[model samples]
Target chain A: MTKPVLHLQPRVKTMISNATLEQASYEIMKKAAIDIPEDYLAGIKSVAAKESEQLSGFVIKTMINNYEAATEDRRPMCADTGLPRYYVKVGDHARFDGGFTGMERAMRSATARATIDVPLRPNRVHPLWRTDNNNNVGINSPEVEWSFEPDADWIDITTVHKGGLFGTDYRMLFPGDGIDGIKRFLLDTLISFGKRGLCCQPAIIGIGLGGSKDTCMQLGKQAACLRVVGNRNPDPKIAELEVELKDVANGIGMGPMGFVGSSMAVDLHIEVGHTHTGGMPISVHTFCLSSRRATARIHADDTIEYRTDPMWFTPYYRRETVIWENT
Target chain B: MLNKVNLDLPASPDDIAKLAIGSIVFLNGIVYTAREGVYNKVLVDGRELPDDLTSRSNVNFHCSPAASKNENGEFHIGGVTATASFRFSKYLAQWLDLTNTKIVIGKGGMPVNDYKNILAPRGAVYLTTVGYGTGALLGRGVQSVDAVHWLNELGIAQALWIFKVKNFGPFLVDSDLQGNSLFAQQGELINQNVEGLYDGLKEPALHRYGETGNRKDELM
Candidate 1:
């Protein structure tokens, strides 16, 4: 859980190398694919403990075994391997040997290398042509999104391998529609994709409220992939709604693989942004059974620390208000 | 405890009859991978399949293994999981008729209509992979990559792969001889309480075009 400092002296001589970044990137890719995060593992265990349906319970127990098998075998938990993508956070004071573009090249090559070494299913392709590059790298295939952190001197990179289909949607609602509208949309997305376990239930459901449509989609996806189970929004009301939504999702009378049970959600996360007063655009994203994600923080000294928890939504990243709105 | 059975590949009519919805299944023998890519090639393009294909194996897997060729030209398969079966429903009937495929394995089960109308009469059954994330376990069951086809054209994800497998399951029987489907039965039970989840949620002020009250086309 690294936090941003208010002010810090910038260091001069130490710079992280591009090779180190690539190595870390490739390592996290493997880790994300094979090892289910500790928090999510605990969350699923709790969900399994309370799952009452006989068959659904069997599925959960099988999943527990699957996770162990994945680690011991050192193989990916799921063959889909998903749409591998990245979130790169650059510390303002950080210095690296290669420029940003060079880092990008390193990341891209790392993606290609990991795809073959780990043999990740090359899931990406041309939108219409369907041409497979076979390396999981093509024209903007493994999307790399960048952000910056203030008063920090380390670059943090998180890779998320999320499924491309199902358990996601976007809708435009009027402010007049209110929270009830949100509830309806959530139920609609869940029930629709939760059929035959298409969305792969007991998933971590993420909701994005406010912002424009595109931002809403990004926020919701980030809320789903970037946050760990049981982590809540900073806003108290949003946090409470998170709890309520999880209960609602779990009470849907469905469990893993869409079987009849009460374990539909591992947890629910909500992210919001100020938007046009006239409309509330919303997006829902469900990070499924194999919620694969991993993070690495590269210090100025080039020492890297890898972990499952992303710690992506730092307080500074979610700060509200502007001291000066106009010049 | 759910009933579990080990099925032999190139199964006979009697073997398919023993399957029932909700039972777990494992397979021993040969299975071949074929989805839209292989389907369009053989069924649509009117191409000929291997002469002894049906005689060799009757199980058509809607799968694409995470596999790669090592420097030695041998394949290293990491994980194996099925793609959604419902999407390939259009090809199954023809595929089954052409190749005598008796067992279909994939991620989600095929449509309920598919079971009753297409599969039952042909003595075919559907088995859905459990968790849909049991790739590693399934990978362990793969004895060897016996052969592969269309690797260059369809690519690995859509290539036709022939695998020798043992203890290859943990798949739930989604459809049986009588056309009864485990998913459909469970779905019906789930739908009974589905409305309760939206008991008090009101409609939004704005509704998108083509937004139906129900997803009638949803697979069972």
Candidate 2:
């Protein structure tokens, strides 16, 4: 049997100019600073529906009002506009007019510009001298991380305004300890620090399992920034664990702002990878209810599309009812 | 029941003591903003209090707001960032004693014992506003912003701003001068809940993950 003859379409080289990249970066940063993503807003609304506690409901309502006011006025949602972080996915086939360094330079300039235009709070302080750079431009001012995608013709950039609130914690568990150990570690951390303004309730919890410490941490951060609320891991066991952890966290009743409420964490996102047989590293990164993130794409033609959802994680179907165990 | 009281600056000990945990206040008059650096400079570094901030009924906001200048070069405040209060609780206890500050406003509740020992004796209350509701707090609550100090030195994070506010809260009185803390009580209840959940899960956790001989240590 002869293989069918296949005709390959000619590849079109996309020319992404530094100016276009800079402008796109600026637009994304501005939008991220001012706007909370639609999915997050929807999650807030959903949780608001379930909030029976008077103060929690009032806080949630106020959050919705604040979101509206911030968007309308083009003001930042939170005063802590936070440290700017950019995650860039470069297509293997895409070519930059000025190369990668040029792209980095463009991102830096765009960040500086947005710092002034969006008037983002200058949260970056000199690490050693403790001096303030009014423009928020210093060594590695806007942290940029890159990844390459094969056979892709467009670049996707997601900007995150990492606030000062959410604190990250990591632990190395013995492989023999198993998944139950991971659960215990997570619960212990959340119970102790979650209410201490670290893991803000009604938060988006991201858990990274089974990697080196750095890899786990990076994956956890990505999970927190890019995962959509109400979405879970694609793996069945991990997805079930996500639901169970969500139930357990919310059951703590730390509530909104750590007051009293039924709604604590709105969603849990877990990313797992194989690790050395001896070590199972776990890292937890939380995004507060305000979860500030935005994404933009630059096509081969240089046409830009701004997106509310970054669309990083796999989506899972929601369970209609969560079974509660009698304690 | 939550009370809607309008508190004036240099609030008297009686006023601070009268407030109860869970009471809502609509603060009027002037409040000064302060964060870590300001606390360090004043309390730790032994800097003198500026005349502008010397009111006996002082309300210090634990905020580092995002403020910007308009085309006219007039500064307009964006809103306040709610930081963790416990980070500054010990310093605040000292500052309150030194300054006789009446009210402290921030996000998250401070240590329970601090409210009982330091704050109650000094005649102060800790109020909590909705976290991340900066725009709502600025647009609807704060009346005006003025006297931005340390804008160039500390950046917006530590720059002290004098905010004139009217009905500026729906602030929950998390800590009152009567040695009561709403959040502290909530924390205790949460602790109980966590303990209960952990206790229930212990047997299952041990059964699933525990070694045959050393079950208890792994659970711990």
Candidate 3:
């Protein structure tokens, strides 16, 4: 005996995509460029004189190089070959055609193809021995972080990148309350720690404020891709702090690659959390100049849309100015 | 202001094989890429490599050679970083010997004693970038991945090496002429500062009435 397949009016849809390794990653790199707004580029110039000159040629060249390489070779632009990370922004009206494990399988296919196609340097070695195992794949390789939003149409898929390379950002640990305690770590980070930690690129600073130690770090990395290029925190106190820190960072005399540039940090994005009665933990994760990321909208209609030009997504380059500040 | 300078440079694979043990390079040209995880699966299990891989000739690309572009328009290049391989510096030295790789880029000077001999024989060079500066260096437009060696079964963000490169940057010799690395100096300075402060604390003249321990010891 055989069971009959059910056929009815379609109320929802699902997409199980498997791109060649290189093809999938190339798509992600394209979207990262469009996500950064034109106004944000202008605003960065307004605050810092150096950005105007440096960003002019810098952003375009980066995008062209990033898009071309990623598309042509089907590999990631920077080699941190970051931890296999995924962001799923799902629509409420839609339902997965298959169960949880099935979705995992689809994403896994995408990641595997990216691994082979992108040819990212496998980052995970045994934590202890540090052996160079050849497989770029790992347990929980493509980490899927999901967010369900109330929306019609269908689910949207976007590639969110936080550079996986070492010293890609700054991490500040708060032991307890004291001016000296925080100052000491802050200064050290800006000095050798910042130099070594940031690897000497103009970076966006992700500040994890008032959270559990681990959450603080997560907030910093998660926020790394958020806070649109030229946007600011709504909180007044945080906004002021961002301004003050920018000034102090520029004062560090750490030029380009820590040699001597106008400002080592581009901007600081700070996120706060509830602290223990006695302690506070703060950290900073720096995103390198490449700032590689992109977004793709996989609609329910089987239409794959890219927000940025998948063929060429440029970084910030010198351009006309437009400022947008909302506090 | 953009300052441009061009110099014809020769990179000896042997020298780089030696120097890269404890140095980082600001690379920007077609360079090969590999990840530890992928190798572990394939080599250990006798897995099949992707088509046209060895013929692609990764060895010449891996070492410090002058810039070259693969068939793909993208340049194969990169600034050196803390490649997890620094921990396997010894094994990679042997790998480089087999591969004929001439240049390597990354941060954190590798341990000099580990593979100076391996590098010297090949005449390769190791280059270092400032740590935490991948963004700045990459932003400067050095290397972009060109062609890649694929182990497709592997997943996203896990490819072996997406080969590419463009501009090349500076790799300061943090190690001394004798191959002593500068990282130690920085690390030592930090250790000394903390140690000295601990030793320099003066005794608290007066003690708290409900003190759990002696004031002098706790304060110090």
Best by DockQ: 1
Distance from true location, Cα of A173 in model 2, Å: 1.2
Docking class of 3: incorrect
lDDT per residue, candidate 3, A1-327, as tens digits? 899988888664354333322243445633342233233334334434554334223333333344344334433444454454566565666554465566656666555444433344445555576543443345655566666544444544555545554433333333433434433334445554344333434566666665677877766665545454544565677678766666655555443334333445666666666766655666766665545455565566455665531211011111113532210
Q: What's model 2's lDDT at A324?
A: 21
lDDT of 2 at A4: 100
Ranking by DockQ: 1, 2, 3
* Tens digits of per-residue lDDT for model 2, B50-93: 77576533888888777667789777666555676778876877
Inter-residue clash pairs, candidate 2 = A202-A264, B10-B57, B11-B57
Query: lDDT per residue, candidate 2, A12-116, as tens digits?
Result: 646888889999999998898788898888887888898888777776776788788789878778777778878888877887789888988888888788877
lDDT (0 to 1) per candidate: 0.89, 0.75, 0.45
**Poorest 10 consecutive residues by lDDT, candidate 2 chain A:** A318-327
Q: Compared with the real two-chain complex, what DockQ does model 3 have?
A: 0.09
Off by over 4 Å in 3: A1-26, A29-75, A125-136, A151-154, A168-184, A196-200, A300-302, A308-327, B1-105, B108-126, B129-220
Candidate 1 vs 2: which has more DockQ:
1
